[model samples]
Target: MKSFLTILFFVAITAFSTDTVQSQTFPKMDTSPMDLAMARPDRNTPPIARVIYSRPQKNGREIFGELVPYGKVWRTGANEATELTIYEPLKVNETVLQPGTYTLYTIPEEDMWTVIINKNANVWGTVYKKENDIVRLETPARNAAAPAESLSMVFRPENNGATLMIGWDKTYVEVPFEKVK
Candidate 1:
């Protein structure tokens, strides 16, 4: 009985010690935390589309033409390449996008932004292959009403469809998605 008690005490100590070490070694919070945006007409309705991405702060730095350079493919937001999932068929720039998940990439310019929907998802950073592109559309960029400290994306309902509004710093762009006819 004494041996059994000794063994139990050692096991308890080992478990508590392991937990302490793990707590101390756990990774710190990411500088760019992941975020999610969904498209739905109302809060009670099911979402038509979803976007999972990371939000990186501006920190008073130039965003568009500098931090995210022009004429270069960007992952759209931050880490883990922006993921877009469509629950239904949608049309963008006259191209039909079937119901599936896709990676959203962008090429930002001074006045316009090229939105690319790639078949590849779950990619990290700016790993882009031209052959993997399913569709690309040009969207005009405009000045936002106010500066967005963090990169942000939201879906606004419009004309029985949805418009994805992306904003950072003082620049904003809109990508319209329509129901497939």
Candidate 2:
């Protein structure tokens, strides 16, 4: 009986161990990692706006007009489309954007980029609909002083609000935002 009990215990341990190993198949880390950028008047103040996006590495490959393609809407980053959250009403290119969460999409070009603010937020992939667009404005794109290995976005505070700076590879663009009156 003792021998029989020992065999049962061994069987139970093996079965549980096998189940544990099979149940946990950890996924590999993403090549493109998600990141966040925010704008604030000062370090002690609350953020006026925030952006969440993924930073995709250049990997020594062509970026703009090639990997990203020109005249096409890009997610602005890898994986999920970039998300923008506005804490207060702000104006972009004279157009007022009410306080809310939005998606930032861009139509890349050789010398210019069309920035689009959409109503949808936190959606997966680059699934875009023209009807959801809130505003679209043109911003000039220029070559960066040095190649950026990863996609990056930063907000610089101004007297009115802030300017959103986006750079990838060897190109960068600035989008200005001002507090609404």
Candidate 3:
């Protein structure tokens, strides 16, 4: 009888220990990306684009199209759209986002260029953000430039160093520094 009780006691202890150990779950952060195609190829190459960023980005206030402007399609992030790159899925301004990829487009002016996130993954380039899926988050665009017509999806690395620059014509707009992991 004593041995039986001892066995039962040990079983209970092991069960409790196993439950305690197994119950612990890793905490999850609220970062959900929309995960769309970051880049595509030229007409013949079938090129593939990769995702780039530092890690741990900031979510700030301001309507995307307001501070960011209205009209042009944006890359959604510093360079490309892959989930949170679209609207609601990932917070662009101070707004809470859902998580999804979007093609970003814009209409450039003196101050802002109406940053937009489109739903189209297969595009010729950062061309028509308006004609794609219109979901979005607006952020203020910054003034940065390269002399000639630079490719749109570029991340110039620096400190935490991540900048998504769109340069076509002499004019340019930048969505700076995204913390990526």
Index of the highest-TM-score prediction = 1
TM-score, cand. 1:
0.87
lDDT of 1 by residue, 1-181 (tens): 9999999999999999999988888688898899999999788988888999999999888888899999999998888999999999999888889999999999999999999999998999988998999889999999999999999999998767799998899999999999876
Model 2, TM vs. native: 0.86
Best-to-worst order by lDDT is 2, 1, 3
Ten contiguous residues with the weakest lDDT in model 1: 22-31
Query: What does the lDDT come to for candidate 1?
Result: 0.92
RMSD of each: 3.1, 2.3, 17.3
lDDT of 3 by residue, 32-69 (tens): 22222243223363312333331112234233345434
How much lDDT does candidate 3 score? Answer: 0.44
List TM-scores for all candidates, in order.
Answer: 0.87, 0.86, 0.37
Candidate 3: count the clashes. 40
Error of 2 at 69 (Å): 0.7
Model 2 scores worst on lDDT over the 10 consecutive residues at 121-130
What is residue 62's positional error in candidate 1, in angstroms?
1.4
lDDT at 67, model 2:
93
- In model 2, where do residues sit more than 4 Å from their true spots? 1-26
